[model samples]
Target: MDMLLGVVVMLVKMAVVLGVALGLAAYMILLERKLLGRFQVRYGPNRVGYFGLLQPLADGLKMLLKEDIIPDGVDRRIFLVAPAVVAGTALAAFAVVPFGDGLTLFGHRVPQVVVDSNVGLLLVLALSSLAVYGLALGAWTSDNKYSLLGGIRGAAQMISYELALGLSLVPVVMHARSLSLSDIVAAQAGLPFALLEPVAFVIFIIGSLAETKRVPFDLPEAENELQAGFHTEYSGMRFALFFVGEYVNMVLLGAVTAIFFLGGWHGPFLPPIVWLALKVLAVPVFLIWTRASLPRLRYDQLMALGWKVLIPLALLNILVTGALLAAGV
Candidate 1:
């Protein structure tokens, strides 16, 4: 019965996380459209519902009702699987992200996270890196030159930024002295890492934007140059999954940024969960604002920024952090 209770708790944790994450992601679409519409000085989906509130539900229904189209000459098996790979990795990484402190229900104490793994940070990085497989495989198998180019760009950009993203977090890990995210949060009780490691905070935020393919790093999906980039051949629900994956990734990065730098679930005058929700909500809105404001970078410029600038800066920050630690600073 003990084992069964554990399983039940785990399931409940997963269900809550998924429901919130995916449900928020769905509404995020409506929010982005509304924000972007306002940004561009136009109306959004106000026709759908009151101030477009019901748009996400309508969009979800449309996607579900749409026909699934598989392009000719594509690898049917892998092509079918790629979108799931993208969406699954984006969602699965949230398992280790703690939303708030523990809560007691029915005489049981439940942790806020779905699974508080010791190697959570590493797992998130690994899962993020694995998302490239979906992009690459989907593009390569599409038998479309435009899709192929988009895939290549997407794969290269993500891999390039991954290095900097990892290095930027190294100082946080060193200061926190644990790879567990919960421990990282606890270590920040006195002060947030963002105030202490400003450089790493900037690098991590910038690297995260690149990691999620948001502008001005959205060269991978440059519509003007290579159609819709890697997902050109995808239609209906398959295409929708890729769209969903991007928003979820934005939320994932926001949560991570909060945990790593902004002090996860820590604030005054509100609940811990509310603090977390505010941070998570802020990130994608920022990303959307950026999308409206910034132009896509050239491929060469993108590569140079990641390789020549961010990575080296991240390394320098890590070195400085190491020296400070050695000096007890």
Candidate 2:
């Protein structure tokens, strides 16, 4: 009965998280378009509903109703499965993220996370790495040279940045002495990791932007160059899946950043959950601002920044952190 109850609670948590995540991913698109319009001094998406509040709904409906075109002479099975892989991996990374402190309900204590594994960071990194497979396979199967080029660029960029991204967190883990994200958050009670390890924070932010394929690092989807990038051939709901996955990845990376650097669920004069939510929301806004302000980097520049600059800096940061820890700082 205890095990069964635990299973039920986990299921409930998963459902709630999935619903909120998907909803946020949809609405974030609306928010980005609206804000981008304001940034560029134009009105954006005010047609479907009042202030375009229903734009996401309308867009979703259109995707559902539109024809899903699997292009001729393509590998059908992998093409169909690729988007799901991307979306699923992105969503799954959230399972171990702690949104708040534990709660007491019906004389039982429940963790805020769906899965509280000790290696939660590893799980997230692994899932992120797996997302590349979908991109690569999708592009290869599409049989389009443009898509193939985009996929190659994406895979290379992500792989390069992943080194910096993973290494950037090592300082935090070293300070916290645990791979568990919750422990890392708790370690920041006195001072958030961002204050202690600003270099890591910067590297993580840059790497994260690359991971999400946002502006300045979005060579993979360079519309001027690759038409539509890896998902160029996809249409309808399949296209929507890739689109939604990007936003969801943004949200996930934001939460991870909040947890690891900004002190997750640790703020004064606000409930822990609310604090977490606000921090999570702030990241996407920053990302949008960046997209508005910065132009995309050339593919060579993108790769050079990740491999030559970010990765080296991340390694240096790790060494400095190790030295500090050895000195008992």
| Total backbone collisions for each predicted model | 0, 0
Per-residue CA lDDT of model 1 for 1-329, tens digit only, reads: 87898899999899989998898889888889999999999999997888889889888888889999898899999999999999999999999998877888778888899998999999999999999999999999999999999999999989999999999999999999999999999999889999999999999989999989999998878999999999999988899999899989988988999999998999999988898889888888999999999888889999999999999999999999999999999
Tell me the whole-model lDDT of each prediction, alpha carbons only.
Answer: 0.92, 0.93
Model 2 scores what on Cα lDDT?
Answer: 0.93
TM-scores of all predicted structures: 0.98, 0.98
Per-residue lDDT of 68-114 in model 2, one digit per residue for the tens? 99999998999999999999999999999998778886689999999
TM-score of 2: 0.98
Question: Which residue pairs in model 2 clash with each other?
Answer: none
Best by lDDT, which number? 2
What local lDDT does model 2 show for residue 320? 96
